[model samples]
Target: MTAHSRDTPQFYLTAPSPCPYLKGQFERKVFTHLVGENAAHLNDLLTHGGFRRSQTIAYRPACESCRACVSVRVRVDDFVWTKAFRRNRAINADLVGADVGANPTSEQYSLFRAYLDHRHSDGGMADMTVLDYASMVEDSHVRTRLTEYRRRGPDTAINGRGAGPLHAVALVDRLSDGLSLVYSFYDPEQRDRGLGTHVILDHVQRAKALGLPYLYLGYWVSGSNKMDYKRRFRPQEHLSPIGWTLLND
Candidate 1:
């Protein structure tokens, strides 16, 4: 088949599985593969249209009666830095990061373990092994990157970035239209640091720096408190029945 043919995403339905976000209700998905020369472009379109990426698969909610998963994207140019976000930046100012290859390391695994232990102890990803983590980072067909955060050392002016052990990281996908945050984790012990918010804030900056227009922030379930924070990024666009609509505060 030609790239043009692949351009039209062929959708498929996933078998029903236990819902991660809700209880009692089963969840299903309508998905397509991100592959070939059209993968990047197709991914951009799908993501913009409310799909989320999982490895090489791009999927969206296709439940018969449920429609809870809402795709969210931050407006890079108009994003407002709230007081809390500003404070997070100040707190994590000492932490620095280095964007390494997608290859995973023992250090990253250790940090991942710590993050899971503290925050998601009984969560789905808690049982992930080193190999599983490696695949999570490396098994991708599109443009992907790993920005590992660390503490700044002396002579910071020389590097213009930090130099220390890894404390946090974000798995990012570089798309033609925007930056998609595939997953992120940070040192959970430093709750005072507000690293979670800081990472999202930092990515907004990164997207602006890269001249990207949006930052894909997965799903935002309205009733889910865990997702309410995503709305804090001002001038964000949420996928609606009519397409992406800018949410003004």
Candidate 2:
């Protein structure tokens, strides 16, 4: 039997838990393991159907009475830069990004720890140890990559890499259609650079260059202040029961 035929994935649901995005609401998830040779194929299919991957698992919110989480993807060819986006790009121009394989490093762990402590101290991943961080990067069975961003050194013109300390990092998955930004973190003190917005814009450019049509931004939870920024990527699509439709917001 082919890998896909032999290893059909079985879905499971998580017990209801306090919703992180909305207070006083509970959240449940339907998930399946993405493993074996066909993991990448399965991931692409599930992601297109509104699932988000975390390590080896693909999951989506399955709340009992709420449908707040909506899957979003940018329409790359139609993504025009607003004045604010141009400003963010100009502010972060000094930085250069290098796409590398999924390998864990001590330096990455240090940055991850600092980012969590500074930004998400009260969140679920705040207490992740070095091991947990490593698993987050290297445990994936499908195609995965890490992009490291840093200040361009004088020799960058020839060497094509940056120097000094790392400023940002993005853990992404290569899907058949576009890049899936799994997680990202940066120097919290450098929020003035607008690194978060810069990273997504960079991915959009990368997707266009690669002839991809979309850049998956995971789920946008309506009414969640933390996710409001995602809605700004205009001319995008939202996964609906019928199909992926243009989100005319």
Candidate 3:
């Protein structure tokens, strides 16, 4: 018998389920638990191999007939800042993001509930309770951080921290190569603020400042309207069977 250490990750496949991105299709996933000391290092390797972390599990699409899910990462150093991107930054100029430990709070849950209620009422996470939300944020074994976005305070210039009510929240994982945006939510009522776009833009700048080469944005399903926004971030690389390929257009 092979001497397999408990830390050695064992991958499993999930039963097929109805596909969320496309109609009349099913989705399956191959996943492994990201626990123990090697979790962070394993996460980096798996992420590079097109896996995404959700809590303590890293999973990738393993559908038999479909290959629509493509892993994407924005090239932080070569990001294209268009006029619209600049405009979005201006719109969210008053907001400041502060990174804190991965601890779930009631305020965050409220915003999360609102976001799901308004945007994803029929989604899998639509009925997530407070406990479920906490597990999502706190159950991670890898390096995870939560960035809360709020209005700039009087001492914002000096402290670089936000004040006032929470506008948005992003749960991110700090990886060896770059930051992976695990999940994010915002106040749905403030649609004009473009909080979602701002979060991605802010992370892009943050990744560049930190000298990271990529900002992993999870999977991008082609032909899905919900994922169309990801295509706007030009100068990005999509993971293919051949390897990461740049997409300028």
Best by lDDT: 3
How close is each model in CA RMSD to the real structure? Answer: 2.5, 2.3, 1.1
Off by over 4 Å in 1: 1-9
TM agreement with the true structure for every prediction: 0.92, 0.96, 0.97
Compared with the true structure, what per-residue lDDT tens digits does model 1 show for residues 75-126? 8898888788888899888877677868789988999999999888988899
Candidate 2 lDDT tens digits, 1-249: 545544699899999999999998999999999988899999999999999999999999999989999999999999979999999999989999888689888898899999999999999999899999999999999999998898999988987788889888999999999999999998899979988898899999998999999999999999899999998998899999998999875
Score residue 44 of candidate 3 by CA lDDT: 95
lDDT for each candidate structure? 0.85, 0.93, 0.94
lDDT of 3 by residue, 41-108 (tens): 99999999999999999999999999999999999998989999999999999999999788899999
Highest TM-score model number: 3
Candidate 1: Cα lDDT at 45: 78
Q: Model 2, clash count?
A: 0
Worst window of 10 by summed lDDT in candidate 3? 1-10
TM-score-better candidate, 1 vs 3 = 3
Rank list by TM-score = 3, 2, 1
Scored against the true structure, residue 13 in model 1 reaches a CA lDDT of 99
**Residue-pair clashes per candidate, as listed?**
1, 0, 0
